[model samples]
Target: MKKIAAFLLSIGPGLFCIGYTVGTGSVTSMAKAGSQYGSQLLWVLALSCIFSWALMEAYGRYAVVTGRTAVNSFKTELKFGKVLAVVLIVGIVIGQWNSLSGIVGLSANALYEIARLFLPGLPAESYWAVLSIAVVILAILYFLLIVGKYSFFEKILILFVTIMGVSFLISMFIVLPPPGEIAMGFIPSIPEGEGGSLLVAAFVGTTMAAPTFVVRPLLMQGKGWAREHTSLQSRDALSSALLMFVISASIMVTAMGALYYKGLTINKVIDMVYTLEPVAGKFAVALFMTGALSAGLSSVFPILMVAPLLISDYKNGELDLKSKLFKRLTAVACVVGLSVPILGANPIAAQIATQVANVFVLPLVIGGIIYMVNRKAVMGEHRAGWLLNTGLVLAFIFSCVISVIGFTALKDFF
Candidate 1:
């Protein structure tokens, strides 16, 4: 137990990355893809993980070498640096906060589902009940943010990520897809349908997340790592990306085995619960919901922190958790996160839409990081190599294509 705890503590930033990327957004997008198209979109998930690793390595390397965060690097390193930094900060905060709404809403709904199983007295679908749950969850999380330090956040995230990973993995084994179908998912081909493009965009957006990379430096700085730790940083990035792929792929496979073979789809959070209960039994449903709720709560911590983190990064590269600005911004984020439950929006749809919206900002983020990492003035002797640069270029191009597809999909949504 001590060894396990020590191992988890050593991978703090990697756990944070996992906590942020493999949250409710990833769960919804991956699950939807699996239910609607089987494992056809697994290609996107694979590619996104690869690019995510490259970008994280680049971002972390920059921080270790220069002791700078993304926005701080953007503000000081490139042309129109200040303008670009502000735009990046604004775009990421807006998108992440929007995602937080869905995160908390879906979390509340999941908790309500679990509550129903136990109490059997609660109304079948009570908006007020869900809202009340959301209030309680957010209140507790805000209190944690107010009092907890970075290491505290890291330890909590490690626990959540462990639970989430274990739950999903166990659930997937119970409803394992056929080996042949899983293998075919590796071959690249888009599913032909109305929402296919949007799901594709959301998958990439949720996995190869801009904020995940943009916030890497701040996280690394908070961990007190430096140039001497470059190798450790690389390993952390690889492990984070690899864990993301495994956990996300497990979710898709679980949906594929449980829903796709039966010609069903997930239209709501409750649908996941209702559909899985009979198919995989109450034990499986419990595991799935536990994972989903854990994913949502793990994400909420980072989502609430992003705005204040970015603002602090923009001002200077340090993250002051106790600052007045940090407290105020996080409070605002918590309130914004309540919007979905308050207004009674569809949490699933809100999650997917927020993810699709995230695609639009990726090109800028990829381009900015690419510029910063390649600059000798900034990175000194440790500038990015040709291989890393090539990956970044590919990631940038991919982001552009997905952004256009995302825009088209949003138009259809309206």
Candidate 2:
């Protein structure tokens, strides 16, 4: 019992980050994955899991060892380095612009589904954006300015969402993928078709380049995680990051295997709630919706956190645990996060832009990560190992190659 308790405690950071990983994008992307490629890209998920774990640990360790966030570290670099940081902030904003819209839009879709049960015409397209933005601001106020401490609040939300997510994961098992098909997911393969390629870019963009990954290590630093750093803690951080990947993959698989595999793709996430009922029967979708909601709310806390972090970094100094700038930044972040959907915004546009922002910003974050990880001075004794380096190189190369492919594929769209 004690061992189990210790294990669970150790898993908290990873689990918390993992909860956020199962957001609307993961759900939708997985649904897309299952529908188009039909488990062919299952291998991509596997490779991503490995890559996410390695990168998170390496990046987080850089922050921990050097006492610098990725943003600040970039700022500290030489003149061209600052240019890199500028590019990073700008690009991430673009990539996340689409993704941020997507998250709110997906939440609105889920809410629309939930509301259809009680009041058929309650939600409009504009309302979702407003509500999402409102919720983000309110959540920020609650944590940042009002309560002043978010540890307990964050923990509870993560726990609740993780439980909600796990319910969906279990249902996927009950849906019973063929052992052979399931095993085949472990093998790497891309799906055939142009749409498949777009979906793949979106899927990869949804989780990997998303702002959430950039913030996880920051969260770790804020939590005083490095003060007591250990190999065990290092492993724990890796576990947390991979756990993020695992839960994300689980949601995708659940949507893909149970929903998408059945030709049940919808334009938005709420469609799953509608379609899941007819195909997977009853409880499975309820579990899925609960998971989706959990995913949405888990993000609320972090979206709130980003504003202040950016502000403090912008102020060009150490983060004072207690300061007005902290409060202001926190408040501003929440507002910015929530401001998008004011007075009712377009749900679909919001949804698509949410990840588009991430795509735009990804190059900088990726560049920062690669540069830092390779700088042995920053990482110290716990610097990138051969295995992590290999994975980083591979992921970096893959991302670059895919950028070319993605550009080629979507050239006409642009």
Candidate 3:
């Protein structure tokens, strides 16, 4: 019992890392993909999980041995120096903006659905914004008021993850997924329509993109003591990340496997959560809404941690996401996130767009990290092993090709 407890405890920063893996993008974009393309893009989801593991594992090791965040490590060892820094910062800002906006919008979509039933008297559009805001307020209060439990940050993240799992799994069973269609999910193929292909790429990108992946070491640093914790931290972080991947892919497969099979196409992000009874059944509605609500809340907590990290890095090259400026940034981002309804209430479209942007932004970030990390000076003896190097190179090439193909496929789409 003690051994098991200690093993789990060694993954001190596990929750925060998982927070990045499980976010609003996972819910909206993956749901859209399943609804639009059925399981045609299940391959992307599987591939994304693999790449996430590689990318995050690299990021974790770089931080542990060097005692630096991925950003700082890049700055220290990068050859192009100023030019690359500018590009990285730009990408980070845009990615962060789109991500936070999409998450807020995703959360709002769930609230909008819930209100339509529970408080039919209120306007869903505006009331959703208010509800989302209240959720942020409530979460912040919970984080602040919960004392020692939440100050750790990962504790709250763990709670969100637990609820998310229970909620989504229940939804899956409630929907009573068709076994044959679920089997077909593993058979990879591109869907026929242009929209189907686009959703596949967008879904892949969104499921993989989030703040915590890049900023993991900072959160981990606050939890564990030093360089000695490096390998264990990486292992723990990877496990947590995989847990999220399972939950995310499960929701997508279940939603797509069942709903899309019925010939009902999903047009908005909220449609998955709200269109349950109208299409599938009352149980479907309840299950999806429950999953969506949990997903929204789960995502919000990590963004709160991430906002401050971005601010601190900008102002002081530190990841002290606790300063007043960082806190204000987090709050403002939250407010902006909640206002996603203004971007067009077509829940699925907006969700997919942000996800597409993630696919677009990925090449830059991933390419930069691969170049920076493998440099002998940066990692010394701790550099990626030769086998790992070969694998990473292949993964990088594939990512670049798919990303380019995806962008070109949707050319002229602004």
lDDT at 325, model 3: 65
Q: Write the per-residue lDDT of candidate 2 for residues 4-90, one digit (tens) a residue.
A: 545756555565555445566666666656654556776766665666676667666776666666666677774576676566655
Candidate 3 on 243-321: residue-level lDDT in tens? Answer: 7667877777767656777776676654564556665666566666666766666666666555557545544455574
TM per prediction? 0.98, 0.82, 0.85
Runs in model 2 lying further than 4 Å from the true structure = 1-16, 118-146, 210-213, 314-353, 376-378, 408-414
Ranking by lDDT: 1, 3, 2
Alpha-carbon runs more than 4 Å astray in model 3? 1-12, 118-151, 176-180, 273-275, 278-284, 304-307, 314-317, 342-344, 375-381, 409-414
Best by TM-score: 1
What does the lDDT come to for candidate 1?
0.91
lDDT for position 374 in model 2: 78
| Consecutive 10-residue window with the lowest summed lDDT within model 1 | 115-124
Q: Over the stretch 29-97, how does candidate 1's per-residue lDDT look in tens digits?
A: 999999999999999999999999999999999999988888987898789999998988888888898
lDDT of each: 0.91, 0.59, 0.63
Candidate 3 overall lDDT versus native: 0.63
